[model samples]
Target: MLKFTTNLILLFISVTAFAQDSLSVETAAIDTVQVQQASKDSTVYKQRYGLRVGIDLSKPLRSFLEEDYQGLELLADFRISHNVYIAGALGNEEKTTQEDNYNFTTSGSYLKVGLDWNTYENWYGMENIINLGFRVGASTFSQTLNAYQIYNTNQYWNEIQSGIMGEDMLGEYSGLNALWAEIVLGMKVELFRNVFMGASVRLNYLVNNTQAGNFPNLFIPGFNKVTDGSKFGVGYNYSISYLIPIFKGNKPQKLPSNNQQEQED
Candidate 1:
């Protein structure tokens, strides 16, 4: 009887130990699955980086509407970092203006290079931007003096018409150039998968100008109108662009708090 009772006690102890070990293994497997699911749910978001190319639509509309104006501008930008872009424009313009005493035409090509800083924060899967930028512009151009009337201080000689100058004063002046800088404020909105529409206002300051000996540079291609004594000018453009994505990058992630991390664990 003593031997039988001792064997029964040993069997009971072994059964209990085996049951506890099996329960521990099942608990560990459940914890591992929970951890994997949590990691999958906390994946980081990705962003696109690429080059965007476009044309200034306002230039084409103006060329169609204005009889004395013709212009074409092509613009491009590339993303170099988060919220920063390298941008540029290349264009050509020809314009004719009739002043009180003179008439002339100016034709030229211009190039502008710049950088843009974006200020907007986008939601997931959106790439809109509000940006402030700066540019340096250079132009090469020529001027043609079509007609002019000499200034006459004597009103009494108006009957004689000595102020009227004929074709003798008509001439073409070449090899003129100019340099300027501008501040740009703009916004861009994504219209479709890879299409965007944008607009910008610019404030320009003329840095240097090369003029003909006999005539002055009244207007520049990219710089617009030149006031008599002012170095400042204003301009704007509307554009539609398409993005050619180059690569993808993970967006910056924020760290969790201690309590949140403990809960996740």
Candidate 2:
């Protein structure tokens, strides 16, 4: 933290000392002018363009067999208004497994439209940003056990099959696929005027679950109602961003426009 403060102080001193180089003014009057008008807005950070790259700290929306506990992402945002922005993102994930019952791995990618609301302003205090987002994408997963997984549970079918006896008592079925929808919430903190860090949590609900062959009126993972079990789960992401201003810096040096300005210049 000390290093951080030291760097900030140095940056201020450098900007203050050099902002005058743009001027042909005398050295003695330079310090005086700064004291009178360094910058009108000194406590806020706003930007026209933002870029963020970070990692997910919780599970991803991929299939359980290849789901990642952590992953990385790269994103870009364009501020459309104060506290509002449009964003585009892309990411990747990987895994290695020992058992061959499932696909070696599954990866996921998504696009989201989100809203950001500034809840607080003090960068070092409780400064917070609330982010709400929605995403659409696909994931990968597969089951390689048997035609009929020895331990399959079907609430609807189980009741109907109970009456089956003899040869009809035993049968087999295929597996399922992975594709889903995502919803997210996040908060950000300013660690530097142009830099910030934050945490995010998201929920994913599967969108497809094909049943055994072409069964009539059957349910699946992303398909019809197979079970009442919660079809959703939780995950988290950690991110950092940089915000660079549009057209302003320390205000430009000026030439006297009138006698009053002549004395100040």
* Index of the highest-lDDT prediction: 1
TM-score of each: 0.79, 0.44
* Least accurate 10 contiguous residues by lDDT in model 2: 216-225
Each model's C-alpha lDDT?
A: 0.92, 0.47
User: Tens digit of lDDT per residue, candidate 1, span 83-198?
Assistant: 99999999999999998877999999999999999999876568998999999999999999999888767778457764757677688999999999999999999999999999
Candidate 2 residue 38 C-alpha distance from true site, Å: 20
Worst 10 residues of 1 by lDDT: 251-260
Best by TM-score: 1
Q: Give per-residue lDDT, candidate 1, residue 59.
A: 94
lDDT tens per residue, model 2, 136-167: 54433332222221223565745754322233
Give the CA lDDT, 0 to 100, for residue 62 in model 2: 42
Candidate 2, residue 87: the lDDT equals 54
